[model samples]
Target chain A: MAKNTSLYEKHLAAGGKMVDFAGWEMPIHYGSQLEEHHQVRRDAGIFDVSHMTIIDLSGREVRGFLQKLLANDVNRLKKKGKALYSCMLNEKAGVIDDLIIYYMHDDWYRMIVNAATRNKDLTWIEKQAQNFEINIDERPDLAMLAVQGPNAREKAHKALGNKILAAQDLTPFFAVDCGEIFVGRTGYTGEDGYEIVLPSQQVPQLWDDLLTAGIEPIGLGARDTLRLEAGMNLYGQDMDESTNPLESGLAWTIAWQPEDRDFIGRGVLQKLRDSGPNNKLVGLVLQERGVLRNHQKVIVDGVGEGEITSGSFSPTLKCAIALARVPAQTEDQCHVEIRGEKRSAKVVKPSFVRFGQSCID
Target chain B: MSNVPDNLKYTKTHEWIRQESDGTLTIGVTDHAQGLLGDMVFVEVPDVDANFNSGDDCAVVESVKAASDVYCPVSGEITETNEALADTPEMVNNDPFGDGWLFKLRPTDPNEISTLLDANGYQEIIAEDSH
Candidate 1:
């Protein structure tokens, strides 16, 4: 049997189609997934993200440990509540997981990782911490909700009540501790929103309150479509332990400056940088009526073949879009094999939609 | 919460059949089928004039979450297919019983549909599946 989140009963009450995801019983959709996707784009929507893993690190050597463990530089987060997105890589430069790290205090940092990667990530982090004196506290008692859209901030403010003022001045990628809840101005969808991390026991009340506040309850189906429209990569689908950040459209997250910082995969990354990565991840927009899907072969006419990592019917764009890993020499026009027939697609930057607007022409 | 018309015949695989006076029959996925599949993104109907026996996979309905095959409930030759679904597949979810009819077929044996289940029988299947 799959484990249930704190809001599982509430989701069932609201007509969510329950499905098993990452060993957890989660909602795939409440009713119409297309409507839910439009809800987030046009107005406010809430997502139950309690399945994501949260770990807190507190120690004198926390910053040093992070600098060596993550591909991104944590030193850039000088101000409190600042957050940085980084990828944890193995010694071979293969990506273990991509996560957001928030600097809470001089000795404390909070990181939220993907749900499916929790056990492996914890094991890897614990093994690495043996050399440094740090405490890794996995906060299973926390339940998360992401309220996102064009008017999400204002609606979240209204729903949160007393914590409104403290969260008002928060900018993107910043977080604030509002007594019992931690509100971060971050989201997976390409929309403005707040991700609230609070005690698990209090989650059902918050979910009901958000629903009463006129926020629609979105599920994992729309969440996937929304994130894919934003060109965000899903951990296991887009890249995994066998894939590296350089080839996964996450090269920008790797900070290679200050030459001697020496992050975990710095050596292999530097070598790849010097020799150049053979494959690059790009966006694909189907010019025809077919829906693009994962594992489809991407045939760049003159160049070599590639494969689609994540693909979906973009509700916002009214068409299909995909993220594909193609040869470095691949250009604008390519053909994707759908069911046996080769269909033409246009290659562009990885983003298709952001802030409810189409990014590609 | 799905509508099951009393006059139609149903299949264990979730398809519905409506016999026509012109010796042809219309077929579509039931309301319960569309409800379970969520929003329909694409529907791949079998080509007109294709022949199939009962239980043969004849069409596909794809939602955002998954793709499911629609099997033929009775042996027939496909006379027509709903082409409008190529652009607006949501019709299946919006009006599954009427405008969302997937295909039409001329029956090889008009009596073959008697072996299929009635609405009450289909409801029983759905109710059991729900549990």
Candidate 2:
């Protein structure tokens, strides 16, 4: 039996179809996934993402602890409430997990990690924290809801009332605490939104309030399509412990400046940066009729073979698109083998669609 | 909810077959199958002249979520294939019973059609699978 989230009953009440995902019973969709996808793009849509783990780190040595733990530099987070996206790497420079770290105060920070990698991430964090004076507190009593879209911030502000208006002016990748609610101007859908973290006891009421505010309740089905269209990397599929961030199209998240930040995987990352990675992640758009899917073979002329990690029909683009890891030398033109038949595809930089607009040429 | 046309016979695998007056058969996936597969991304149907035995894998329907094999409920020779699906696969997701008809076949033995389940029997199969 899979564990259910705090919103499971609320989801069922709203006619959600539950599916087992990462040892948790989650709502795949309420009714039409396409409608939900468009709703998040055009209007407001909310998702119950309490299944993800939230950890709060607080101590005088927290900055030092994070500088040594994460692949990216924590010193860059100078402004209070600012957030940084980084990857926790192993000794071999393989990506353990990618997470968002919020600098709440001088000595306190909050980290949100993927739900599936909760145990391993905690274990790794604990082993490293043993040498520092940091306190690792897992906030299991908190529930999270992500409301996203072009109108998401307005709708969220309406639901939160005047007290949360401070979050309205929050810059992107920043968080603000209003009373008991922590609202972050961040989301996975590549849209303007707020990811609200509040006590579990207040979640049911907040969900109802959001519904009353006309925010459509979305599910995991639409979430997958939206994230794929946004070109956001799913931790397990896009990069895992076996793959490095450089090959995963996440080199930007790595901070190599200041010359001597001795992060755990700095040596291997430096070596890989000097030599270059074998494969690179790119976005593929099918030129002809056909949908590129995961594990589908990609053939690039003069380069080598690669496979799509995430692919789907972009509702906004009205065509098939994909994220594939191919030979670093591969160029724009490629072919994807769909059902043993080669279909023409064009490779480009990612962020194919964002904020209800086309990001690709 | 879409109704299963009374004239067509369905299989446990959610395939509907229509028997023509001249003993020919036209096969397509059911609305239930398309609903389960979500968006149809690609499809692989057999060649027009290919012959298959009963219960053989003759076609494939790949969606963004999964890929499923469409089995032959009755042995037959493929007489015609829907070429339009190669360009617009969403036709299967939009109209699985009508425009999405996969292929036409001339049954090796016309009597094989009687072995397929009727609408009520196919409904029972869906009910059992849900549990």
TM-score, per-candidate, Cα-based: 0.95, 0.94
Candidate 1 residue-wise lDDT, A1-361, digit = tens? 8999999999999999999999999999998899999999999999999999999999989999999999999999999999999999999999999999999899889999999999999999999889998999999999999999998888877876885568899999999888889989999999999999999999998888888888999999999999999999899988888888989999999998889999998999899989999999999999987788899999998789999999888888888899999998888999999878899999999999999999997
Best by lDDT: 1
Where is model 2 chain B poorest over a 10-residue stretch in terms of lDDT?
A: B1-10
Clashing pairs in model 2? none
Which parts of model 1 are misplaced by more than 4 Å? B53-56, B124-128
Tens-digit lDDT string for candidate 1 (B28-121): 9999999988888989999999999999999999888777899998998999999999988999998898999999999899888789999999
Top model by DockQ, which number? 1
lDDT tens string, model 2, B1-104? 55677788999988899988877899999988888887776788899899999889899887766778898879989999999998777899888888898988
**Which has the greatest TM-score?**
1
For residue A251, model 1's alpha carbon misses the true position, in angstroms, by: 0.8
Model 2 C-alpha lDDT per residue in residues A1-361, reported as the tens digit of each score: 8988889899999999889888999998887787899999999999999999999999989999999999889899989999999999999999999999999999889999999999999999999999899899999999999999999888878876875777978999999988799999999999999999999999999999999999999999889989999999999888999999999999999999878889989999899999999999999999986567788999997778999999887777877889999999998899999878899999989788888999878
User: Comparing to the true complex, what docking class would candidate 1 get?
Assistant: medium
